[model samples]
Target: ASAFYPAALGQTTLEQWHDLFASNAQAPFFLSQHLAPLLKANQGCIINIIDALAEQANPDFIPYSMAKTALRTLTTALAKALAPEVRVNGISPGAMLWPDGEHQLTEQQKQKILQQIPLQRVGTEWDIARTLYFLVEEAPYITGQDIAVDGGRSLNSVQLHAP
Candidate 1:
């Protein structure tokens, strides 16, 4: 349930990400430090919320895609090793929640997002929630998989922006 900064490589991205690269990609290591504690508590499941960019690189987001792709890899690797004691998986949500008051969302912007989705509509948070619910409640046998809650958006290349 976290959001990243402007991924709109819409020309303003470089200015936004200059410092991130120079910054040591530090969070994963810190999180890695906590894995043992979570396992000990028997809360051995990790649900990674990856981004839309994990599957498709939008014209507006190259770095974001790169980062999320790395995260997707982690999701798989961790799941394999943590089996029996822990489960690690991911869910990639697309257009589930509008940025709302944090970001100025206009009808045109909403339309632009939908234009890139085959469903011709954005997803509601409930869509993502239900998908996660299945991964958690219904699928104990299903581990190490990533469920994409994108309203089938990732399937259509033309429906996504390419950089």
Candidate 2:
């Protein structure tokens, strides 16, 4: 894709990873490769959970971010292309969970994040699941957009410190 977000992907060359992520010319792309059939059958919607860090800021996971951003864009494009039949949308989650195989988090680190959230707490998996359920089963008219479940982290600017 571009330069600034250059990061080593596992063990593969950065260029190779970039090609795999940003500009794959293969058929079905990704979700369509598998879900095209299922979605058509069930007339279901696509809820792609694009990470908040995707197009945001991060020193680590830069390559992953680039890939997710492409996925997010695809969600919008797919929604429009499949409109009046299939629905597609994205959810951008911010600081939802620590990465797997977690190490201990410092109290300061935890407080720093909590303060940024207007809700003043971290999000849980249930929060996401319920939201999806609503947009899918409840909101029949919704599509082609993202509902940010960030607890207002995107608006954060003021510094927070643990007492």
Candidate 3:
């Protein structure tokens, strides 16, 4: 499933927020639940593509953050609910794709974001894909985990007060 949804507060209505949550979070949970039998029989895995904002608050994108956080919670819940039959995990991506058109970032904004990432770069889609492959094919003993494929962006630390 894709994590495409509308963001922005105030401009986004309550109904829009609900729709975003339903599509981003609820759909995955229900789909997984509906496919539980098939997954259990085949020992399958569910990998959710959440957002890095799920782990942190983004004042500018409250709805999107909430939806992703819900998905993250659902991933852990399903992992336990599905148990040994099916593995459930999540990948939270950070700055993998540039926003198009009006949402595009300025060079300064882009540099600021990159500087926050310890790796000083954005991740590739392939990074997330490889992690998914590992969770499914190699991580037999692993479940109920959310891997951050974020090029260390999530580890960026803020100094509330400078040293």
Clashing pairs in 1: 9-60
Q: Per-residue error at 16 for model 3, in Å?
A: 1.6
1-163, model 3: which lDDT tens digit per residue? Answer: 5445556766888787878788888899789989999999999999998888887777777888888889999999999999999999998888886777877889999999999888888888788889988998999999999998888887764437667
Cα TM-score per model: 0.73, 0.74, 0.90
Point to the candidate with the largest lDDT.
Answer: 3
Residue-level lDDT tens digits of model 2 in 1-163: 2222335446557566656464522222464647777786788887877766775756555566767777778888888877777888888777776534345567798898888889988788988898888878988898888878888887764368999
> What's the ranking of the predictions by lDDT, best on top?
3, 2, 1
- What are the root-mean-square deviations of the candidates from the true structure over C-alphas? 5.2, 6.9, 3.0
Error of 1 at 131 (Å): 2.0
Clashing pairs in 2: none
Ranking by TM-score: 3, 2, 1
Stretches of candidate 1 off by over 4 Å are 1-3, 7-29, 40-43, 101-105, 158-163
Better of 2 and 3 by TM-score: 3
Highest-scoring model, TM-score: 3
Q: How high is the CA lDDT of each candidate model?
A: 0.69, 0.70, 0.85
lDDT of 1 by residue, 24-64 (tens): 12354247447747773675566777777678757666666
